[model samples]
Target: MAKIPKVPKTVLPKPPRQAVPPPPPYVPLRARPVRPQRTNLPNQQSPPHPSAQETPIAPPGTTRSDRLKQVWDERPRVSDIKRLTPEQLSAPTHQNRMNKWRQWTLFICGMSAFGMGLYGMQIYVSLTTAPDENAVPDDLSDRFDKEADGYDEKVSMAETMLFLNSRRKALMQKVRGHVLEVAVGTGRNTPYYPTKQCATVTLLDSSAPMLEVAKRKWKETHMEYFSRVFFKHQSAVDPITPPYGAQDGYDTVVQTMGLCSTNEPVKLLHSLEAATKEEDGQILLLEHGKSHYEWLNSFLDRTAPNHALTHGCWWNKDIGKIVEESGLEVVDMKRYNFGTTWWVELKPRKGMRKQLEDAAKEEVEVAVQKSWSWWSFWR
Candidate 1:
């Protein structure tokens, strides 16, 4: 509604045009289509395609050779590539005669070593076999006493087969504080005992002759370790009570390859449990029995008679089953060498003594409450 004013317009200059690039020259399936010469045959007149005359111009910064390679790669099948022959494809990269000979030589050496080991084991097992059943420790003791000097050597011969020394070493290394080695035959386990960490050791045995050899073994190597070492004349089934006082029960009880021949193995186990401190005392055992494999078990069964008779070892004893029946809490149990060999650690059950007493009392009560009856026939 008020006065309207006219505004002046300013114009800007347009930019100048430069030369435009031409479209890239036509490219064919092949880099070069054959061109016809002036004197060529009648139908091939002066190259049929006008593109032949077109002369390709490569993009800036690229040579004609690079353009040629791009077209070449686009082709589905490359005519210039060489194919492999069947003979070359089948040839192994590492099939020299020297390699073949080396492989065969290694195989032969391995088999020879295996055969030699087997031969040595057969001789060793035969030598360690006891001459009679271990019905009496005195009988076994008498035999062992005569062989005491040669005993260590005989066992050494079977180390690889039976793993006797290794098992003893492992069992003894674990024992500490006041310790007990029951059925401490020849003191074979003393060599590995952790006596430096322990206060005292009590070596107990029923067989006097075996004790004598064990005593000699102690005097030889372990003489300086113990503050006090007692040699007790006792059986495996006997309780660790009386004269020694606090040293009677132990922190660890070690038994290796010894329980397999006892007259009453489970009874011995019960007695061993009672002899240890009920709160924390442990038992370490490495024992063998019938192998799980049918063939091996059968062989053991066949050999068990003469084996027990001569070696005083019952080869077919099921050590695992016996330990379970012994009422000790097996904290850890491992089997090796075809389920025949067992490495077990057991602790005293919380109320073992009470359980045995209760069982006995129940048995007596049942016997007294019994009502006699000649039984009526199927009425």
Candidate 2:
């Protein structure tokens, strides 16, 4: 190892002290000199000149004592700041207040929309289920059509009830010949039936309570007509074969607000057709059905099940197609009461009577053929 060289002593430079200059000599300002006033000589008074009576004037910069008195001209004393600069009160501040208002408005609107949405959801959920349908009896025929007094009076007081009853009366008057009224609740239409046009009337329903009411009403209003009116307690789809009697069959069948609650409307119409004279019989209807409007139909579909559960009625049905497919020709059809219901009158097609006869003959022939084949096989 080489011997280390001797280290030199390092000295740090010291900062110099700056001298602070002494403050300038203090001197008091001299007072302004006052001018001497001239005095009048004793006993030698100069004759009073016009200029002598004049008030003494103040020097250039001096103001008169009375004039110097703060000009307190009752300046409109403003309790607040009076002279604000334009920049201090600009439109930007006003805009900030408006923005705050807009925010508050938006918050209120959002809350209102949310509440409405929840209410609508609740209504929709209640209307589209089958629990209500299961509660009704399979047959509601006799009780609904029972003749009763005061049934109309009891129902007509409500606006909705009165409207339904009035329309029912109007529709029943159109029936003729051997007439049948289906689901004739409380026999309200019994008083309105045209006895002249209809030689006999058949009232059909399934509810026993309703039929009892109808019976009382029919006996009270038109007992003579009741003699011609027959009451039947049966399901709409029950068979009406030979034992039911062809002479007793109806030529004109009417239904109002009935199809909505039927278990199988298409089958019900077919059964009605089978119970009548195919060539001469007709079906008249005034009923609310599934709407053609997409939105309305959707709403009805969703809510109908709920209505059935709560009101013992269905709100959705396709009455037109059920009638048409029952081998009837639609003669007249119209939407009534703002498209809420349809009124239709239909008759069997000209060819339908012949077709039925042919079908019956074919059925017999097929039975004969099958019997012959069985006999041959045994032989």
Clash number for each model: 7, 30
lDDT of 1: 0.70
TM-score of every candidate: 0.58, 0.52
lDDT per residue, candidate 2, 303-355, as tens digits? 77666544445666767667766766788888755465888887755555445
Q: How close is candidate 1 to the true structure, as a TM-score?
A: 0.58
Output the number of the TM-score-best candidate. Answer: 1
lDDT, model 2: 0.64
> What lDDT score belongs to each candidate, Candidate 1 first?
0.70, 0.64
Q: Point out where model 1 deviates above 4 Å.
A: 1-141, 242-248, 353-379
Tell me how far candidate 2 lies from the true structure as C-alpha RMSD in angstroms.
35.3
